[model samples]
Target: EADIYQTPRYLVIGTGKKITLECSQTMGHDKMYWYQQDPGMELHLIHYSYGVNSTEKGDLSSESTVSRIRTEHFPLTLESARPSHTSQYLCASTGLAQETQYFGPGTRLLVL
Candidate 1:
């Protein structure tokens, strides 16, 4: 697994707060993805990118946004967070072997 890390592993904030969950990978993988998961629930893909400047929404529709400005950085942002946005955001990256994914410690967001 690639060395991936997520910032602010746990967060609690009032509603309507602007939030940015940072994800950085040291393996320099080209394929990165963001997923959302509620407690004890299945994960849902929210965004992905094949490489820098190549971003696309994932299978699940999301109110948040993501950017791939650099190969090592992929951050998800909510312009205005809400209670409904409370969930764990996972960051994953796949190397040449696309089937294998290395995941970071997820950022658990709890918007009041």
Candidate 2:
């Protein structure tokens, strides 16, 4: 199996609620990232971390926040979600940016 995993492959949430997207990896990768993607399109960086306790915001705007505690786990949380927050969340990791990043199947979220 792939090293990465994301739960709730699909989620339909109501407006103004809290949600957390789980991401974990078996591989001992120190780098982890969270990206937002629209259907049939490219991915946009939303959040990233180089190592433990080193988290940085991406160039894009997201209502979500991420935390990295263990080397193999990173989870994103949305304090209050809206319809505008609906998008596919892809979790990825790599030893380096130039190297290939392994991605999770993604969590497709829709808010109405």
Q: TM-scores of the models, in the given order?
A: 0.96, 0.94
Residue-by-residue lDDT tens digits, candidate 1, 1-112: 4599999899999998999999999997999999999999999999999999999999999999999999999999999999999999999999867688999999999999
lDDT of 1 at 33: 93
Q: At residue 89, what lDDT does model 2 achieve?
A: 96
Which candidate's lDDT is highest?
1
> Evaluated with TM-score, which candidate comes out highest?
1
Encode model 2's per-residue lDDT on 24-107: one tens digit a residue.
998888889999999898899999999999899998988789999888899999999899988999999987445879899999
Q: All candidates' lDDT scores?
A: 0.94, 0.91
- Candidate 2 residue pairs in backbone clash: none
Q: How many residue pairs of model 1 clash at the backbone?
A: 0
Q: In model 1, what are the clashing residue pairs, if there are any?
A: none
lDDT of candidate 1?
0.94
